[model samples]
Target: MSTNRELLFKYRKEGISDAVIYFALEECNGFDHLLLSQNLDKDIKDENRFVDAMNHYINGEMIEYVFNKAYFLSKHFYVDNNVLIPRQETEQLVLNSAKLIREMFGDKPIKIADVCTGSGAIGISIADVFKNNKVVLTDISNEALSVAKKNGEGLNNVSYLQGDMLEPLIKNDEKLDVILCNPPYIEDIKTIDEKTWKQEPHLALIAMPCTLFYEKVLKDFRRIMNEKYLLAFEIGEDMEEALTKLVKQYCEDAEFYFEKDMYDKTRFLYIKSANSYTNN
Candidate 1:
């Protein structure tokens, strides 16, 4: 009820939406200025704690990481320093997955795999909707796997694994019906990508040298993916051409799709297995 101006300075870059902060303050009941400042580790005590927090966030610490949470598929998801913040555009990926599930398997239970499962957002959201379906969450980083486990702690019919690309998934014997991946596709664009991307964990965003993660995942797909499966991925707008080319390496019969997000950004990729689905 204060609406104090001092509170506004706490968030400069608008790193988080105002509504989320307000909701967190109300539901969590811990938005005291003094407590926020004192407990906000290394976040400056100046007029711009927001900027200070941003810097630490770049270094990968939680700060007022206190109020950090996201709503995916109309449900709340808790995220912290170890996890990459879920993007609004990612909801499209989940929606597309749900649509595919409904289309292919109808109301019957199906199997799905979410690769590069950061915080388990996509898989968890999908699993929440298709409660009877089996959803497997896979991530390479132990820290990220821990975050995913936390996100999906109580969910039934979901499994978690830690391994590279398609490595962990082989344990399933390649019977997964759907493969959902938001792999690191932000290929190194020497100039533009550096300025905004330096903030996230290099491991989560970068895909090593010349090979982007999406390409690797797809190339491996022809070998690892089930004969009757679909793969959906969150993609970089400018990199779709590059991605299509990557998908071709393994399966020329693959279907390429451009999914537009809320901001009208083409932020998603969909590929139907050649052995599974006809071009549609």
Candidate 2:
């Protein structure tokens, strides 16, 4: 049986990063990096599974999908090829939205929806934080929703709906105080790397013109949103001008702005209704 240290050295020699190797070892063996490091001489738990996971990684599968898990806002979410993996920028979206929610609504219970919710990461994370708020997650893909449902299993404040964008909310007569979305915003499929293009779901990617989903939701915003509400989106870095135009076209009287992620990229778009409260 190969010991943990031996496997680590083996994979590291084969060009895998320590981060990937540690992640795989932790997932398959239930030992985090610290524990694995401390017990390097111990035989790996489920060595076959670890090897299989490494094989999948070597073959170009995303490490998150290889293990069916992803971390967002420091919370673990079940993920698969059916949904786009949660990203750091999207975590920024959630954090900023959460902070704004507290600043805007305080402890008052509000209805929140994460449209185009893949893996239920955004909605589930927000629901976990704001236990007083009600969160609804909507995804067009049933398979994706299944993964989301699995991640959302314990959250009492979270619910799942399957539909394209905001249609399910409209049909269900759900009016939300805050709508958060990380829709498919890539215009050119060619811009994505070969590994991502091959491994991730195109339905959650490849939005022609990049603003396709944004336009759809903005066009029908009134149908699903309350009179006083906030709309947030994870946008492409280059989309500020076009999305500004799109938001103005649909929400002429609303206040909206673009926010930068940790990497300083303009990656989030936030729109507030004319009646919504502002700290200023």
Candidate 3:
């Protein structure tokens, strides 16, 4: 059994980032940051598992997938290749949705849906924060939904439905106060990096013309939406023009706008019921 300090020195020589190495070590060894700092001479119990994780990382697997965990909105989510790993930009979408939810309906009990919820990250985060609200997580893939179910284990306010986007809601005659989505919006798989294209699930990444899913959602927006509602989407950076056109065509009476991410890329689309806009 090698001491933690010796294991760290050996892996650090592999040129991996200190953050990545530390994260892998802590997760594999069940060591918190304080434990890691205070007990460098402690023996690593599962050195082989740590080595395997490092090998996966070195072979272009994202650390999130290698560890089967992703952090979104300060919550840890279980993830696998079956689901798309949550991204930082998606975290922004969650933040924006929460902010708008509070702004539009403070302390009002509401129903929220995370359409195409991959790991249930967005909906689970919202449900965790807004205990008064009901959250529905819908996904098309059973395998993906299984991963989401694991991530949502402790939340009493969340329900998981397996179906195509919005179909479950429509079938159930469910009307929601807020609808948040981060659907697959990639225009061309070839454009994505080799590692992502090869490793990430394509069903969660690629869509023909990139705006197809958005159009599908917008075309049927009113069918499953409450009279006063908000719909938010995490869109591809290049999708503003096409999505703006779709929203205008399908939701002419709605108030909608495109928002930029921290990088100043047009990465979010928001549409609100006309009455909601007037009330706010």
> Pick by lDDT: which candidate is best?
2
Superposed on all Cα atoms, the candidates' RMSDs to the truth, in angstroms, are 6.6, 1.9, 1.9
Residue range 53-111, candidate 2, lDDT tens digits? 99988888899988888878778888888989988778889889999898788888999
- Model 2 collision count: 0
User: For model 1, how does the per-residue alpha-carbon lDDT over 71-175 read when each residue is reduced to its tens digit?
Assistant: 666876777666777777888788877887677667656788899888789999998889998999998888888888888988888899899888777755656
Task: Output the lDDT of residue 239, model 2.
Answer: 95
lDDT for model 3, on a 0 to 1 scale?
Answer: 0.88
- In order, candidate lDDTs are 0.69, 0.89, 0.88
Q: By TM-score, how accurate is candidate 2? A: 0.94
Q: Which pairs of residues have clashing backbones in candidate 2?
A: none
Clashes of each: 0, 0, 0
Better of 2 and 3 by TM-score: 2
Q: Which pairs of residues collide in model 3?
A: none
lDDT of 2: 0.89
TM-score of each: 0.75, 0.94, 0.93
